[model samples]
Target: MSLSFDVFWSFRSPYSYLVTKRLVRLVEEWDVTAVIRPVRPLAVRTPDHFVRMDPLWRPYLFLDTKRTADYLGLPFARPRPDPIIQDPQTNVIAAEQPYIQNLTHLGIAACRMGRGLAYIDHVGSMLWDGTVVGWDQGDHLARAAAAAGLDHDRLQAMVDDDRDGCEAELQANEAALRAAGHWGVPTFVFEGEPFFGQDHLDVLLWRLRRHGTARRSSGEAVDG
Candidate 1:
């Protein structure tokens, strides 16, 4: 038997970025498989949520994320273009529309191709690392996808066109995530247990190891 975990990820999430780096290492070290399930960020699916964010939330996020970045020694900066790509004057988010659609769809596509982890790391880094000013541009996303060894052109074309096949798959992922009892990014689920946030990864790992040992000792096949 092989151990497997499902990761509920969101590209618009800075916390997801932090989790990705650690998750990559965990899967390799533990010899386990990670099932990446990408979903649209809360801002897109529920704009009202964004509007309700407290003013202090932004500063709090910066402080917390900085501490996490320092601890992990990973590059950290506020996203340049920000996930909410909109015109200040008109309050229009044309530039952002494609990203919400594409990021969500790309996860499903990568899963289909068995390259879900790669896709998440590459694209998620670009969105969270704050290296680029505007990630909404097709070129930026394409380049990131290329870095992940995926066919940039094909992925871009699919995302740009909102191909029904991909969109439908993403919707399913979102539904599954919601049914899993979490609406946040970087949620890890094992045996129906939900752990939300990067801060909980260690706890999750402990659970996995404990469960693995118990199963093995009970004469059950050990998962990797």
Candidate 2:
């Protein structure tokens, strides 16, 4: 049996985007399963999250994310409209947020179709790679879905067909994240051990190896 781990991720997190590529690589190379568990971003989970942050947090986040993206050779840019809508002056989260809600549901739908990691990686690149201005407009998500071998219309239809079910799954994922002892994105939980942050990916890999996770043998086909 393949070892399995849960990847707790949020669409609004730049660090989540930063770690996805390597997570994809890890699945391809290891004898393990990555269960992508999409959760509402902190802004949604805790309406007062940003409001309570230190004044310097936002500035440092921008500076650090850009440099980290550059270091990783990944294209970087602020999401054009931002995923979570909030008042810039007051950090008050908007009551109506369509972007993240749609993305979260779509993520759950893709996971149900067994392409969660691929879906996030392709779609995330579109949103954060500075490639498109209005990523939510037109057929952008559809094209990204195609890249991940998913039918875009079908994916959306799944979410539309069972919005409540998807929301329930998301809530369960959030509960699982907390149960795993962390509430952060890009957290890789192996055997219930929570490894938070992209910077700790190497440590996670080391731990995986120590627990006997092995490289895929040549000629063994890897699948999502």
Candidate 3:
């Protein structure tokens, strides 16, 4: 009866990065299973939708995300290559794939290799710590993936080529995230309730603790 949660994450969203950082610790300290389910950010999924948003909303998001990060004791900085958007041609040439494909697969691979937490820690720290500008540059993600005992070259090749295997896994993650009732990044699902944003981690943790305790009191077995 171990409590498990699915984190629908997106690398492009600063909130997602913050959520990853905190969730890594919660998973370890609480001895709960975290299913890292990555998906494309809303910007990519519906660029026109974002473009049509009230202009004030865009700037407000940046300010709000930074303020939230400060409150959480996490680093906050705008990533280099700011918008993270690609033109149709460049996007297609880059295989037009979501960054989540690589990240989620790496998480899954790490779990398979018994290094899931390690993988989350290294990669999430680098991405969210606000140290690097262009976090997607060469060797950044690759090095983190390597730390998880994965073959960085093979993973990159699969991601770059947009291999069907990789695409399929990402598609599954997207489906799962959507089914969990959120199309946004940093959404954490517990008992079928979607808690959106890093700001909600505290609530998510409370839920996890309550669930774990209730199960334990009921004489239910817990799994690691």
TM-score each candidate: 0.83, 0.96, 0.77
TM-score of 3: 0.77
lDDT tens digits by residue: candidate 1, 168-212? 777787787888898888899888888999999989888888777
Number of the top candidate by lDDT?
Answer: 2
Off by over 4 Å in 3: 86-117, 157-162, 213-224
Q: By summed lDDT, which 10 consecutive residues of candidate 3 come out lowest? A: 215-224
Local accuracy by lDDT, each model: 0.75, 0.90, 0.66
> In angstroms, what RMSD does candidate 2 have relative to the true structure?
1.3
Which pairs clash in model 2? none
How accurate locally is residue 107 in candidate 2, as Cα lDDT from 0 to 100?
A: 94
Q: Between 1 and 2, whose TM-score is larger?
A: 2
* Candidate 2 steric clashes: 0
Error of 1 at 156 (Å): 2.8
